[model samples]
Target: PRWRNIFKSNATFWWSFLSGIAQLLYVFGYLGAIRLTFMPTAYKTTHYRQPLLDHNGIDILRIESGYVACIFRMPSYDPSLPDVWQTDALISISIALTLFLPAVAIIVICSLLILRKLRIAKSTDISPQMRATQHQLLK
Candidate 1:
């Protein structure tokens, strides 16, 4: 009963905590999208041809390249270039959002709703039988 008063007193605080968790999720999601979208992929070039100087002229080597290291040299990679820092940051953020943030949000929202319903019951003039039934059903 005393603790019920505490929950009643802190309804706004619980709501704010839930809002904060949601806002954290929003911020992390936005940052993760940015990191994933604008990140550079290794450049690719196809059918690369060049002129060769011999006694009279020109030749070409048709090639496919992943990254152009220089005007004369192009390197190919099996996968795109890696950015360890960005990748790690994104992964850490995703874990925090997907795992930690949702759990916190759920706890805060459930607590807030329970407290709000309890406060509503307290404010309303309900019969003792009704209160017992509410507690039994809810708990």
Candidate 2:
């Protein structure tokens, strides 16, 4: 006997459209959240007092109020610190997590569900064909 599960729809276009909308929403929400909340100057700087003149050749210290005046970032005039590389390092890790996390979660959930169904399929109620396939698989 065929497994007539209505969990599947005969309409391919509807599923495709739904999938496209879901993907677009995920991308838009992820990017929009990042854009809305991300601060360009979201870093701590170590203050240094120059004795006489330093490498950039000015004997004064400068500080500006942190603000996101516009989307485009102005060139940073602050002295480079060791922590600058940490931001760059986090970029790859963040990208990989964001891209694969949902996919991995879905795969894990589906695999668990399949395992559960297989466990129950050992019951005597299922079709002989499926039972035969089950026996073959167990072998």
Candidate 3:
């Protein structure tokens, strides 16, 4: 009952609650979409490695220095690995915009309204002490 009254009376509290809920929903939806789109494979390695085989069931070595030459197989998309960071950044931006933009707008508007009200109140007040101070300052 008390919490309900607080939410009803406080615009800031309502904005925070709604923003948090929106953020949680966006994150869950994004995660669910990622899961549905990219099914996890048994081996998630980006690169595959194959050792050179010899006739004796051992790795073949170079004749000159006797060092094995390892073969690495990279996916065709390996060159685009840096784009993964960009995707993460995009997701971060989306989440921030969704979660914070409305709350920030509301806060800014509320602050402006409060400041305007204060200014109006100050202008309307004609206290004798304030009038005396104004006269002194004029002199």
Candidate 4:
């Protein structure tokens, strides 16, 4: 469609309209929201065993002992689930790759096509004004 007719695209025009509903559904489903499953928790490993002592060998900084505020974890998660899915890194990387790969591929392909078109427009004897307008609109 022409640049001016972009806003007047018909209902069947799917390329111009980008919706987030699919991503939302996929993300929620993949994360097991419907099943009330909260997998992949952080694990606290912070520790301080060395205590500061005064001249008399008394405990100077008596802050606390075993106070771990560093980690979160999926404590008491279901054991029936696969171990691979329980890992945060696996889930995150897999979900991102699966959801975004197709979109990224489509964008790259469309960008190449537009670039080719622009090159052709430039190679031809088209007015520089028209070429600039096309480039701007494509962008």
Candidate 5:
């Protein structure tokens, strides 16, 4: 029974660590996706799966180039030009907050809970008989 209780406390600690790791992974995943979309990496091939056509029925083209560079390459240097990828930065930030913040919160809360549980368990009065038995067992 004593061993079982100790196991439970250790389990709580591990669960908190796992939750934090998951959140951190999610934040990185979102950032990586955005970077791949708007800010393509040199390693990831320029080509990714794209829809055959736009919503307006216009065909989409796949060029051997990065999207960010392509946007700036347009002639006339139109300062007022609308960007299709403008929302990506916002999405990245949102993902970072959603995944990373909650994970951190969960880790902190769980750790506090476990610590409280430990303190309470330790502060409980031990019966003289149980203490004697434990002492004999240790000897």
Candidate 6:
């Protein structure tokens, strides 16, 4: 019984460690997926609006037209912005579906196994011969 207790404690410790590692891996895998899928792209000014010549004598093109210029020049490539919010949402859903839930399932299975072992140990009756053998082995 004493040795079983010791082994049980050790098993619990190792199971906790493994679960921690699994959780860390899940988080990293999710982050990696987001990084790979929605990578940042270079901003393009022309995509938003046509450049206009300044009223000054200088020939430099200006991007300061009215509301149309404002509408055209808005940044749309970054994933964190409202323009690309759907991309971020899709990446999050995909990672959760593929990686995070599986890790949680593994942790749950380990917990259930430990509970089953404890229940069996409590319900079993030790015979005298087995108790004597266990005592002798401990000595």
Q: Which 10-residue window in model 2 sums to the lowest lDDT? A: 44-53
lDDT of 4 at 68: 17
| Clashes by residue pair, model 4 | 42-72, 44-71
lDDT of each: 0.52, 0.46, 0.48, 0.44, 0.55, 0.57
lDDT of 3 by residue, 30-104 (tens): 555444323222232122212123222333233444433222222244565642232433454465456456655
Q: What's model 2's TM-score?
A: 0.32
- In terms of TM-score, the best-performing candidate is 5
Model 1 Cα shift for residue 124 (angstroms): 1.4
Which RMSD values do the candidates have, in order? 12.9, 12.3, 13.1, 12.5, 10.4, 13.4
Poorest 10 consecutive residues by lDDT, candidate 4: 43-52
After superposition, candidate 6 runs with Cα above 4 Å error: 1-9, 43-96, 118-139
- Descending-TM-score candidate ranking: 5, 6, 3, 4, 2, 1
C-alpha-based local distance difference test score of model 5: 0.55
Q: What would the TM-scores of all predictions be?
A: 0.31, 0.32, 0.34, 0.32, 0.44, 0.41
Clashing residue pairs found in predicted model 5:
none
Best by lDDT: 6
Q: Please list the residue runs of candidate 1 whose C-alpha ends up more than 4 Å from where it truly belongs after superposition.
A: 1-7, 29-33, 36-38, 41-139
Judging by TM-score, tell me the better candidate of 3 and 5: 5
Q: Which has the better lDDT: candidate 1, or candidate 6?
A: 6
Q: In model 5, which regions exceed 4 Å deviation?
A: 1-14, 17-76, 79-85, 125-139
lDDT of 5 by residue, 30-59 (tens): 667556445544422222222212222322
Cα-based lDDT at residue 66, candidate 4: 24
List the candidate 3 regions with Cα displacement exceeding 4 Å.
Answer: 1-92
